[model samples]
Target: MPHCLYLKHLDIVPGDRANPCKGLMKPITIVYSSKKGYPLVHPCTKCGHLSRNKVAMDCTQED
Candidate 1:
């Protein structure tokens, strides 16, 4: 089954734009399926932006 997830923390404070003082925050999309071998990837859903760095955009593990 293909599961679709919508990111909670996207675009710095849940908006399309970002704050200059806070910096730009982006959305991260993760896919986990045995058929695809849990391909860990991040693609901005808020604005269709792509980033090569996964760790930088990880908001779930943040303190």
Candidate 2:
């Protein structure tokens, strides 16, 4: 029910485009990790495939 993004390709394995699930990745929650920082948890609406990805970092902005 949350906001989702319609990606042209799925990156479940990070750059792996062979995945057949072309579902919209819905952002469900924000997860915190000591090593990975605050990465977002996105699950596919169609296949329910989930992935954790780091937020885009701005070069001019401090992390």
Candidate 3:
């Protein structure tokens, strides 16, 4: 599994019609770990948007 600080572009919101920023992949920065031991958070490089990943398998860092 990749570390929390890996670089990734994930969907800001999976399925939210009200989300203004939709259908866009934003770069993520794993700021820190969560107490639940499953919550992963990061910010988008393009829009400074914050995103979370529950599953480590869903996290990816690419060059």
Clashes of each: 0, 0, 0
The residue pairs found clashing in candidate 3 are none
Q: Point out where model 1 deviates above 4 Å.
A: 1-40, 54-62
**48, model 2: CA deviation in Å?**
0.6
lDDT of each candidate versus the true structure: 0.41, 0.70, 0.50
Best by lDDT: 2
lDDT of 2 at 2: 46
Question: Any idea how many clashes model 1 has?
Answer: 0
Candidate 3 lDDT, tens digit per residue, 1-63? 434343345443564445443333343434445564555565655566676755556545554
Cα lDDT for residue 28, candidate 1? 48
lDDT of 3 at 21: 39
1-63 in candidate 2: lDDT tens per residue? 343333333664777876777777777788999999998887778887778777766433422
In candidate 3, residue 54 scores what lDDT? 59
Would you estimate the TM-scores of all the predictions?
Answer: 0.25, 0.70, 0.36
Task: Compare candidates 1 and 2 on lDDT and give the better one.
Answer: 2
* lDDT (Cα) of model 1: 0.41
Model 3 regions more than 4 Å off? 1-12, 15-37, 57-63
